[model samples]
Target chain A: MTHGISMAGYMFVNPGEEILVPSLFWGNYNLSFINAYDAKIKPYNLFKGEGLDVAAMGAELMSEGDKKILLLNFPNNPTGYSPDVREMKEIISAVEQAAKAGKKIVVICDDAYFGLVFEEGIEAQSPFAWLANLHENVLAVKVDGPTKEDYVWGFRVGFMTYGIKGGTEALYTALENKTAGAIRGSISNTSNLSQSLLLEAFDSPTYQEEKKEKFNILKSRYEAVKQAMKNPDYAEFFKAKPYNSGYFMCIELKDGLDADVVRRLLIEKYSIGTISLNNLLRIAFSAVAVKDILALFDGIYSACKELTV
Target chain B: MTHGISMAGYMFVNPGEEILVPSLFWGNYNLSFINAYDAKIKPYNLFKGEGLDVAAMGAELMSEGDKKILLLNFPNNPTGYSPDVREMKEIISAVEQAAKAGKKIVVICDDAYFGLVFEEGIEAQSPFAWLANLHENVLAVKVDGPTKEDYVWGFRVGFMTYGIKGGTEALYTALENKTAGAIRGSISNTSNLSQSLLLEAFDSPTYQEEKKEKFNILKSRYEAVKQAMKNPDYAEFFKAKPYNSGYFMCIELKDGLDADVVRRLLIEKYSIGTISLNNLLRIAFSAVAVKDILALFDGIYSACKELTV
Candidate 1:
């Protein structure tokens, strides 16, 4: 909440400035900016083939007068999509053009599900490391938390870093003071005990090794989910999007079926709850067991067969 | 911060409504109500004889019109002074009359330093238990936190309970829903880890025993401070107010001696820091060692002697 508020405060984009957002975006992005910051969010429909709709993003940026900020999310929420190197370069070029055009483009990468790319082709990179030293006009604000990565949902421990010109020390000091002021004015400070616990965990010798093991287990489970979706009965109900990392996968419902109807039937009749986004349903593969994935799909398939339009 | 915002949000008394405040009030109250709520703060000046000016409080209540909220703090900050039974009764009477006048009076008892009353005559009680059930109009809102009580400053863990006409269940449910909504709108929720840790601490058998021992230690330290303040060199410098609980005490400086001047000298020359409120210099006994109490006063006394006035 603190980080979100801080980022929203710094977003000084002018009226009608086109900020590119993927069609498959987190609901909170709209809530945080359009609803909260009162900035315009121009949605670029995602490219059918890979990661982000880079070509569409570039065209949108060129079409709009001047881009002030480009919002990016990797290992994306609700879709579990990560842009490959080629697509990333195209996105970067569009951002560079915005920067060169004298529009102070603040790239806010909401890396909430960062470092969780699972698919064979998809690889993740910290945008902070990539764009921090790039240009004076191009500032990258990275918002990441322990909620997803460290499996500490209740902790609410997150940090925001600004990559700007001048040494890291100067940038950090200015950002820290502003951030601390925001914190003091809002919630005062994060839990002293939570910070202590996280510090302890980070300093622990086994943390990295244990985290890697957990990541591998999640990856295997995701693979199982992908393999199970290929089965005949479930395959006919929906088309599974290529998901490399993160907990969720987006499944496009069949033409005649309603995603919300399927979601309600699955929950009420089958005791399964999944999130429906328009014509798509997002299933969290991380929570369900590998052995149970097939059974869960079978149940969903059965419900769809009975309740389909 | 959450409690502060909630209090500010609901503290919308009509233009003529009187809100009683202590002379040595928390700074935030001024910001929250006077500046924000636009409510008038009628300060009941603390008497030099009695730690709390309860007689003045009662007189003010009897004289003023109805529709008032009496804000009380015990084991008070910047002056760890709790009122005796006589003073407590006067305050109770003041509240009772306000209730009888058909005024919806809220007795906001900030029990931040609760369970720390050390003196025999200056014991503390849960005002909610006493005054809340007295009249339907007399509502008691007890705002306390584990931050100070549990020695966890950074946790930002606080609880608020409403004493109302309904049974405990209904009151709790209403309070919970309102507070939870406030929390949701502000920071979404408190740190889950902090809540878990606090719950664990409360459930532990040895927690109370350990806390009692710490309380005794604080009590002893406060006693030492009282004895040191009685020293002849310091006694004449300022009027000593009775401090039985909490972390601090305020010394009423001589008529001509400026508190800021004294505070500055103490900090600059002696490397000691204390807060100043007009003519009063607040000394925090909790942060300093017991044995160092006399020495600290000695520094203050010498600083006072050096002043030409």
Candidate 2:
């Protein structure tokens, strides 16, 4: 997702141009744009109390007054927020309206978590599917991999796919040549040996079965986290951000305590590890041993209360 | 080498600044600097009939009149020319003189063919050893890998080491952070699995012995190539570029035949595969069998005569 953001940043948005990201975004996106491309970040509100604020996002996109990149990372890292189908359409419509106004729109859909859907209403599909040919100026780029989908991390393999509306095959070819030429200039290519492993995994008879088995386990963990948060005791220290899909659920510190301070106290006091971003504590329920999911939140509850104002 | 070029390019040279490369050099360097970094390539004469043209290269460097990057790859690809110590000193002297003239020179020594030396007089040692820290204004970067050195192309493991004169360890540390940050923005990092494989290769009991065995075979092929070119029949068609220390050697056409045309005809008529660049044909003897080395040149000689102008 960060690599996609970086490439899109340099390729599409020049230095000093504004990149409109949701207030809630993967931290790496900042590094990707600002550090890598020298582009500035302009944040729109991401939530109306844990539900996606498509209106604020649309308003920011429309009123930004310049051509910009729309980077949408679904089942977003840290927050694990995925837009439902209608919200996804609203996201596309914002870009479409902006593009229709003669503004160049580079819509990058970072689908790192493509199919980890546990929530009923939210869609796991990428916005790129419908938004790709949405407008002529919309250079839709989809960055994805079986790295997260197939549960392989060390592979370091992913792809950057493009779909630009009203572009000829020749145009796309040239764009591909540049992108690939950039890759050649960068890492040559991803590992051929890792590709072989992924290919074999794709061909294996148990591939779907194995993937389903892992997906179900993750789904169970999601349910466990939901149940864990239902405990009344945690309400005093933090407010749970609505999360139904993906690996994490964020807890906003309610007593106005610093998240990192609480995080340190949690480590020192309760021997629990959690990621503190801004004022939110992110809990990854994906790899939490099934038996320990509830106990993990219990630890968080105690740590928060101990340091509460 | 390409990655190092990309980093050294953006870090050292500005967008429009020119990079001076040898006339006979890897094609990727052009793409690496220009496509990725927007830096242009300025070619210096690499050969005076059969050896490194240090004097011409030195003159080009002196007269170009700008703070420039001098990129040199030794055990040279496609041409297989490694400078002897005296020639290397002459090459360093060019940079030294340029630095003395207040031109900030960033000398990148690409050591891809580090240990694959087959000649007695030529030094396979990196130019960074002597050039680095030699001048206050000169910054030296060496790019090398186990891909060619350990005969593990699939691993794709390489390194970038820097040496800047009078540079404190703190400055180097900061430079490293920026380099690492830039790399993070591009490809994250090289595959750790590949690193593990390379580490194991390093630890193997027969590591040095096995490398020596492979080195001996490549050296034998080099001798075979040098011996095969002694045929007077080949002399009429093409003059062999004086190659002594690497995988490939070039044959400059004597009869003014189109190298690309001869290349196509050779593939169709004699089932020969060789790289055609400008008026030269490159042959890699590293992988060719010793017995077939003579036959390969025979095919080239025949093709040259058949396609003669």
Candidate 3:
């Protein structure tokens, strides 16, 4: 875990440079910056709809030149809202422009919840695979591990790589040597056993069949929660938006209703716990049983009603 | 693994500091310095008869202040030799004196082969348990894993901690937080399955009995190898010193005989393979059968005799 983040930090920033991260990002990123690399991190706010404000992010990058690296997590955490493809393209374009202006732009695509984008025909394309080969100055890094994807959190197996690039063999060699040097220096080597198990799992004849079934189950649970939120009692408590994929969704509360207070009330008063993300209450739909989703929402609805009065 | 090393690196050295290591030490120590901490490594020579040259090491550290971090490996790999207590004390005292002189000394005791010291009664004590309490500026770190000790290599379980003066709550808190941060950042958490197996192995009622039996088997094998080296026919080709414990013994070749050439000749001509360290060949008595000890030496004896003229 430390290796993965530190590796990510080394890939994104140069010595004494600053990188931009979303304010609502995973907390480990902060630790990686301070503990792994002595670099600066600038936080950008997520827009009202819980997506990257492309215009604002572009402006920040434009102001900073190539000294800025942007880290994006979508099917975003704490709030499972993924931006539209148009928004993603805009973000990539802004990064490309920054790269063209003699600045090194590293884009870290953390596709943890990648395949679970909920909306039909709204598949999330990895910016890494797209941008890697296109621009020389633009370096794309993809950090994905089997922990969440394979539902094997204990495996502790992850992979990092230079997204598709049109680099010479020498360039690739240097990158691989440095990465291997990093791996060699850290824990010596990843567990050969873990790597073997992951390889076996991936190569299993039933892998695709198993993966599809699991994905459908989580997808159904997410849909159930989205539908349950439509009940009038809960409707006033949440601002509904298009939620296509992933295990979680965000509900923005009415003004004067603190998400933290509501979260505590839900836990203490209703024995239900949800994560508070600023003004939004993020519920993990995959964690609870599908049959219990309606009941869970009922508790949230009651808590909101009690708080409203 | 990477996180473990990175944290280990931090535990020993400060940012931009230099660490001294033996060329034969684990490759990851170099990785930890270059990849993880951006620190430099000064490689020192391992003496022929003695393991590490204490006087030369002292000369190196005397020039560099107490800010020097040294990684010491015993029953060393590629060449398994644990220094005598007198030599170890000399090294420790030098570091201690440097610390008292206002140098910050961090001694990382890579006790991977802690219990495997071959010499009877001359086994090195863990500098870890002593250094923590020795001086305010001195820190002794012990890095050990159940891999070698418990014969559970696939478990990938190990521990890192300050052995000496970390008795205070604040010290404990800082150590815990730093280690946790490293663990959280790297592999997230080690395999819970691996830890469970190790815990169970340690708690097994017959654990000590099993270990003792294995130790005796290795001891018998070591004695056989030592006895075989006493043959008049082999005496001129090899020189054997007192090796009371551990899995391996060193064989010093006669003058003008290269260890690497002799090793290849033994392998190709006699189908025996051994690790060569300069003019010395390391023979693993633990894994080799007692019955084969004479045959192994005869092979070496014949190879050296054939090549001598």
Residues A116-159, model 1: lDDT tens digits: 88755555786666777777788888878877788777787778
lDDT per residue, candidate 2, B15-92, as tens digits? 778888888889888767887667888899898865789987777667756677888888888798899878888888
Task: Say which candidate scores most in lDDT.
Answer: 2
Instruction: Please tell me how candidate 1 rates in CAPRI terms.
Output: acceptable
Model 1 chain B poorest ten-residue lDDT run: B3-12
DockQ of 1: 0.27
**Candidate 2: global Cα-lDDT?**
0.81
lDDT of each: 0.72, 0.81, 0.73
lDDT by residue for model 2 (A1-309), tens: 445555566567777888878787777776677866678988878888657888887777677466767777788777878888888888888878888887777777878888888988887688888777888878888988776788987677787889988889899898888777776776666777778888999999999999999999999999888888888877788888867777788899885788999899888888788899888999888879879998899888877777764
Model 3 lDDT tens row, A50-96: 44578777777778444668787777776676777877787778877
Sort candidate 2 into its docking category.
medium
Clash count of each predicted structure: 5, 0, 26
Fnat computed for model 2: 0.43
TM-score of 2: 0.93
Q: What's the best-to-worst order under TM-score? A: 2, 3, 1
Give Cα distance to truth, residue B8, candidate 2, Å: 3.0
